[model samples]
Target: MSRWIVVLAALLTFSSAGAQTLKVRHDHDPWGKCVGELSFSENGIVFSSEKEEHNWSWGWTDIQTVDRRSESEFSILSYADQKFLLGRDRPFDFTVLEGRGMDDTILGLIQSHLPRPVVDRLPEEVERVDYEVNVKHLHTFGGCEGVLRFGPDVVVYDTSHAKDARTWRMGSAIVGVWSVGKFDLELEVYEREGGDLLRTRRFRFQLKEPLDPDFYYHLRRKLVPVR
Candidate 1:
């Protein structure tokens, strides 16, 4: 039976080397987030949610690039193409995946399917952060209160008793921030027009209550990787 045992061991090793299933958290907006199992095979990756009816799989060749959204989350696939070199025919359709305990393992497994250059470009970890800052209305004698909500793709300035808030798209805006008087912050926005400097807007914010000490620090870090 020793020969039979050796054959069995070889078969088990081959099977393990060919496929693996890992626990992960899958996220795709509108469809929402769910805990699932991600199976890695020689051909492609298969994802199955806890719900019996939900299952999807895609091949490595179908992926363009993967974006890391957080330490445990990755935008694994996106589909888009240009037409006639004019502009993109359509926007990207993203496939996002999130894993907690198995993040590194899952990421490593995915990297193995990619080329060395692509694997080197992947981030070790990522974090998504956004917040609202309290700004003071300096134009008027009796200053009004305002809040600036900073997000990944947009920045919004809302004034108290205002009909509508002013919004700015982050893509075409260059913003410079600095610490001002005790617990106050200053923001200067240089709006761009077709790669040229357009106009500038300025605002000041005060931090009355102590929030995260690293709020400003983290904001700068987030902006660096925007491009």
Candidate 2:
């Protein structure tokens, strides 16, 4: 059979086996705490999140990893075109560009781009974590409910602990990438407070593949939505 045909068959088989779910850790913002989980099967991919401080939870499923290129570039077909690029040697340059669709369409796009080897070499396990922090002005009232007005605003240190701060702060996304086999990865940190972003960081690690699919899934899903 041709390589493409074999890949398609493998994807079909994997999808039918059942969905595989992975956990993502987020520790970027001080005020916003987020943990994202994703599942993939023959049908496609699904993403769910457990976030504190938000009024409602969010989730999406039936995403396919249609195309895969090297460890850096791939494409998925969902709404417009979901593209994944790992840059020359800088995998931290990892980007998930959205096409035309609801905010949920990116998941489907990612599903359509997964490479055959990456899918075929599925690891038995995977793991990941993200951390963030935010400092915001706290509001307080003086007396009666009707007389409630802004009190002394203080900088409140918030992390994943707060159950009411789900909307991520601006410029507050930090990411870490891990490749299980050779252990190749990268870390990117962004500043989310103040009118101007004042800080940023990046790091790299060497890892191998047939790495952990679960690990990659966790990392990808944990990514803060860029508005």
TM-score for each predicted model, relative to the true structure: 0.37, 0.21
Per-residue CA lDDT of model 1 for 102-220, tens digit only, reads 34565556656643112111222113327766666554354557666677755666665342234444543436666654467666665321212224656556655443557667665
lDDT of 2 by residue, 110-225 (tens): 33433211111111111121321222222242211110011121111222333212221112234433333423444444322221222343323332223355645644445534
**Which ranges of candidate 1 are over 4 A from the true structure?**
1-9, 50-54, 69-71, 80-102, 115-227
User: Which structure among the candidates has the greatest TM-score?
Assistant: 1
Model 2 global lDDT (CA atoms, 0 to 1): 0.31
lDDT of each: 0.52, 0.31
Question: Stretches of candidate 2 above 4 Å error?
Answer: 1-16, 26-33, 52-227
Please report the TM-score between candidate 1 and the true structure: 0.37
